[model samples]
Target: MIRKMELKDREAFVAMANEFYHSDAVLHSIPESNIEKTFDELMAGSPYIDGYIFECDGEKAGYSLLSITYSNEAGGLVVWVEEIYILPKFQGRGIGKEYMDFVEEAYKDKAARIRLEVEEENERAIKIYEKKGYRQLDYLQMYKGK
Candidate 1:
C-alpha cells in the first residue's frame, strides 16, 4: 500500500532516501541536509512537492518524491516523478507498477503528463518504465540551480 508521508515517517524516509541517492540508481549522492530540507518542506505542506511512503505487508519498503509544475508544452500541469526507490529485497513484487498505477489514477484528470528521469544504465527500471508506456523525449534537459 502507498500513503501520503507523515511526520512519523521521517526516520524511515530519510534512511531510504539516503540509500537511494547513494545507490547506482542516482548519478550522485546528495547531502543528508538536502533530504532533511525536503522532509521539512513536505511536512510544512508545500504545494510544489509531494512525498509518499510505500508499504508492503505493513512494513515500510520504499518512498517516492514528486513535484508539480505547469508546462506550456504539455498544455497543463505536469507531475514530475523525482524519485522512487524500493529496497533490494522488495523489488520485483509489483510495487513499481503499483506506483505507476497510483500516479495515473490520482492525476488522470488533473495532469497533462507524468514525467520521470531514469539512468540509462539502470536497465531494470528502464524495462519497467518502457512496459508502462513511457517514451523518451528527444529534447535535451539543461538545468541551472542555485
Candidate 2:
C-alpha cells in the first residue's frame, strides 16, 4: 500500500533513507531530529515538498520524496522526485513499480510531469526509470556545493 507520509512513520522513513544512501558517502546520516523536523514540515503544509510511504505486509517498506516547482517556461506544476527507494531485502517484488504507478495515477490531473535523476552508473535504477517512460534530459545537471 502506498500512502501519503504521516508523522508516525518518521523513524521508518529515516531508516530507509539512511539505508538507501549508505553506499554514497556524500549524504549525511539522517538523524532522528532531522526526521522529526521533516515530519513536522510536511504536516505544516510546506508547498515545496511532499512524500509518500510504501507499506508491505503492514510494515513500512519504502518511500519517495518530491519537490514541486512551477516554471513559466513549462507553464504548469513540475514534480521533481528527489528520492525513491525500497529496502534491499524488499526489492525485486514489484513494490517500486506499484508505488510509481500509484503516483502517476494519483497525480495525473495535478502534475504536468514527474521527474527524477539517477546516477549514470546506477543501471538498475536507470532501467526501471526508462521502463516507466522516463528518458534522459538534454540539459546537463550542474551544481555547486554551498
Q: Judged by lDDT, which candidate is best?
A: 1
Worst 10 residues of 2 by lDDT: 23-32
TM-score: model 2 vs. ground truth: 0.86
Candidate 1 residue runs with Cα over 4 Å from true position? none
- Residues 22-116 of candidate 1 have per-residue lDDT tens digits of 99998789999999999999999998899999999889989999999999999999999999999988999999999999998999999999999
**Alpha-carbon RMSD, candidate 2:** 2.3
> lDDT by residue for model 2 over 47-121, one digit each (tens)?
988989988888788888888898676678888888888877778889877877887887788888888877777
Error (Å) of candidate 2 at residue 4 is 0.9
